[model samples]
Target chain A: MGNTKKNDRRDFLSKFGTAFIAGAALSPLISNASELLETENNVTEIKNFKGSFEDLLGGDYTNIKLRMQDDVRRALKKPMKDRKWAMAIDLRKCVGCNACTVACIAENALPPGVVYRPVIKEEIGTYPNVSKINLPKPCMQCDEPPCVDVCPVEATWKREDGIVVIDYEACIGCRYCMTACPYEHRMFDFGEKYSDGLPLVANYDKRPSFEYGKEWDREDRHSSPIGNVRKCTFCAHRLDEGLLPQCLTTCIGGANYFGDLNDEDSVIAKLVSRLNVFRLKEEMGTEPNVYYIR
Target chain B: MKKIFYILWGIAFILGCIGVAQRFMYGHELANYGNRVVWGLWVAMYIYFIGLSAGAFLLSSLVYVFKIKMFEKVGKLALITALVTLLCALLSIWFDLGHMWRAYEVITRPNLPHSMMAWMIWLYSAYFLLLVLETLYAFRIESGKYDGDKLKSYQKKLGILATIGIPLAIAFHGGVGALFGVVAANPMWHSALTPIFFLVGAIASGSALFTLIFAFFWDNKKGEYYQNMLKTLAKIVLVAVLFDVLLEWAELSIALWMGSPEHTAGFRAMLFGQYWYVFWIFHLLFGVVIPVWILATKKNGIAIGWASLLVAFTFIGVRLNIVVPGLIGEKIPGEASAYIQPRLTYNYFPSMMEWLVGIFIVAFGIGLFYLGNKYFKLTKENNSVKS
Candidate 1:
């Protein structure tokens, strides 16, 4: 249903854009005809009246008409906000299954030796009286992001809807962002591929944004120049279609919660208020958007 | 003479090309680096070369601004060295950048308020311009054709410019050091003294590089002016080395006294862990200690020249110690600090392509230097007033 709405919007934008251009091209002809009509009526005094030429034309001057139409088109084409995308990981409910990590790899079709998410195991106390804890780690998506600061080319930036994004095309693989990230979230695109299971999958053709919406394309995936850095974008492709992140959806123990903190009424926000939520490296003042409830 | 130089240049060019090819093909995996040790030899080399440039430029200021007759013979050479080393430093960073093409965008659309890297871009560009203008002025004076009126006016203008440049040179290198030091998350590098340490190291290494290069150029022909220039430069090098050592000791002692586990871990990594040999043996013993001893004890001209060579080589080691050890440990282990040993066992052997490109840059710098010297008559005879 959401896809149909988006398609309708896209269609409206395409037609509007075409009409705006056509209107701009025909404005002079319309003005000339109006002038001819005025001359035929012997209305020479109309030319001397002091008002904008646009007002004189009395219909629509092409530039302003096109501009208004373009604005409408842009508004229609703006990305939908149905999925106020969020993630919740309940540490108390988690088991050390490592299922989410495996799921993320499978879903993302990650390159060999690259794991987008990893489960970290920590043991506390002496050997005899020790308790083990499993923590699933993903990109923190910090509010005051350090990675964005040190990106020399401004390739990585924060989106208005509160997600950090990597413009892979613009990133010059300097990895300064990797160095700056205290969370150790960023990864270098070494142009590695997984060719073992399905050799042809390694050669999967990449489609443009219109086709696959920045998911996976053989030509465009890591082809963003090898030296550029990359990190998780909270599954923007899935989020666009009102779906939860793969890790969040596939968690075996249901440990993660994803939602909008901005909405006071959101379930995640209510849960966060009730539980003692924490973020990693809070002392660094990065103010990560991801919250953890122990 | 030109043929021999060209042949040597060609060889260096071929080797650098191979190194670059390997770097591109293997994705810096060929270099001795990993997640834990993200920075390695290239970063060290970058800092080292920048330090050398700053040092040489500072020394040139002595001749140009302070009117130091004893160091006049090598002023133009120092300027040329400054230019070349800066180029080399820039190239090192270029190869280090994962996305080399988007480097320009760093300038066009810079992130302000919180970006140290952005500041570095602006600072480096300004510093490069200052060096170019100062060097041009130095060349003009090196030409004997400078009439009395022009000579006085040029010196006055250059002296004023050099005064401003000295602080800028200090800041450029110090700023680079602070780039790493300001990252509070990196317990190894975050320090108030990091900028000061960088400045001292730049001066020390710069002096060492100049002493070595000056001696080599001097060997081509002997002159009283050249001898005096060497003695003065040797003295400057001695002072710089002592200050550098003192700062290093102070920095290390403070780190030990603070006794933070992470800080201690970083220091120990340098003193005894993976980087011990490079830090203790090459950086301390060869770079600082032996050179200090040689400079103090050596009386013969030949001995001093050899000491200068040792100093130059050891300074390279010092740069490695500064860059590598700080980046070897992890704030968060296992997850954060992935093992990043260079694919090649020795950690680094710049592939043939890398060497070829590196040497080509060097050759270009040398060619410029030679032209500057030949056309401008950059000899002490050209520097004198008839009165």
Candidate 2:
């Protein structure tokens, strides 16, 4: 018992020592990381200095993120019916990196067979004339959604705030809506995991996802989301939490924009009006809320 | 021959049980159908079997509604076939659902006025109830088994039920077609002609199945009466097939001649793609030419029996053509390649497990019919002279 007490004390002391060294080592990187990705890539402005430097040379758009955050904070104060969620993607800025796709997968805890957003790539020409285009497709959240009309059970519906939401508990997974959606955005969850054949399911695969603001643990194979069809919700949970979507947070291009279209002053609304923007399959009359600024 | 057939059935049933077990344990993972080509063999089979049920029930209408004396003996047998096949259709579609248990939601929280599938379910429910009533009345008032007022009451009830069922079957089966037709996204299935074609195909396939069942299984002596019945049933089958074939030709020709890639993609793929034999050989040669030739040439029981069987079985390939091709090529090109995974495939053929499960539905349907026959005596229970 005396030996155990000594060992425990030593272990505690060592842990403290390691944490102090690690914190000291990471302090500089942490401060730098906060300012590292804040500016637009081309920012070259000289500004009044706050630090010891003669002048601030760049980072003109460093506070742009804060401004967007403030916009979201203000929007969240309004009633649900008064808010209309929408997205604007600048196609010229997208480099086809697919960081947004990866981040979305992480955020949703998507299994192997299910995906909400995938970056669609196309190479336009041959050899020296080659140019590539990337289109990141998510659920359109149409005002007149064909998917909503095709479901035998009323498992999916558009929210008052304009996000299309599926009740995983109510979805029978018939996949009728999948066929009806011209964009083919809805994906069926075939109850697969990343570690399907392995002895232990991957750690992240077991993580609970907060979708539709509900805690969904995918440990049970015969559970709600497993046997149900799923789609993008525009990261409504994060919107409710006054934060940007994981896709928007991770997009290296600064191409993805999300805000309320109902608020004319919102970023998405401004982008839609300022640029040559259009929704996919406008002839289908789905009234898609997502717009692409080409 | 009978012993050999029973042994083969036993083997198939055992294999089917393994498939059913696999489906329950692993879910859709063991199945080949994925997100892109969402419907597969089972969906084809669901429509095929449901078509057969609708056809068989409609064939019974000749006896009960139209009061045709020639088709007097076919009513009960047709009803039994209808019931059994309908049960199989329900089973096949239920199994296709990701959450089979939640299928009750179609009834509980249905989205009607917008969903053709919801309309289909409601119509099917009504049809199922009417069918049960009609079958009960038919059974209770069997031939040479009812008295004066009892006979009239049973016949009157049966007549009323059949009258309701005719329109019910058309609406439900047409609604099934409309279910595909209404999906304006898929240009191939969006045509207004789809529901009409489905109705006629159901009659063609369903009546043919009933005729085949009657030819071999009915416990009637191979006399003048039997030969007359076979001739009449075969003629009905032949006419229905001709009508269905005509409609099919119109669709193929129009789609091919006015070849927009989007509209003609499914048809071109059906005719010339990898699984061309499904359309050319299975559907055309076996389903149409051979059956039509045999049926037109002779009216013998043996000849009509084989011809009807060919038409009934090969119609499955036709149903497959309807489902798979519509969803085949990239509706949006490169969208399939946009995300790479096993289930995100654009091309599909049924896996072995799928075929095995199909066999199970058929075997289960036959088993139920056998029990229904033994208990209810839908057809006369007597010995048959094998050729």
**Best DockQ among the predictions, by candidate number:** 2
lDDT of 2 by residue, B242-304 (tens): 999999999888888979988898988899998999999999999999999999998778889
Q: After superposition, how far is residue B50 of candidate 2 from its true place, in Å?
A: 0.5
lDDT of 2 by residue, A1-294 (tens): 122234553343234333333443454676753354333321221122122111111223343344455567778899999888888787765767788888899898888867888888888888756656789988889999999988999999999989899999899988899889989888888878888889988888888888989999988877878878899998889988999878887665566888878776666666676547888989899999999977
Computed on alpha carbons, the lDDT of every model, listed in order, comes to 0.65, 0.83
Query: In model 2 chain A, where is the ten-residue run with the lowest total lDDT?
Result: A48-57
What docking class should model 1 receive? incorrect
What would the per-residue lDDT of candidate 1 be over residues A136-165, giving only the tens digit for each residue?
A: 778888888878877666778877656788
Model 2 segments beyond 4 Å from truth? A1-34, A37-42, A45-64, B143-145, B381-387
Looking at candidate 1, what is the lDDT of residue A229? 64
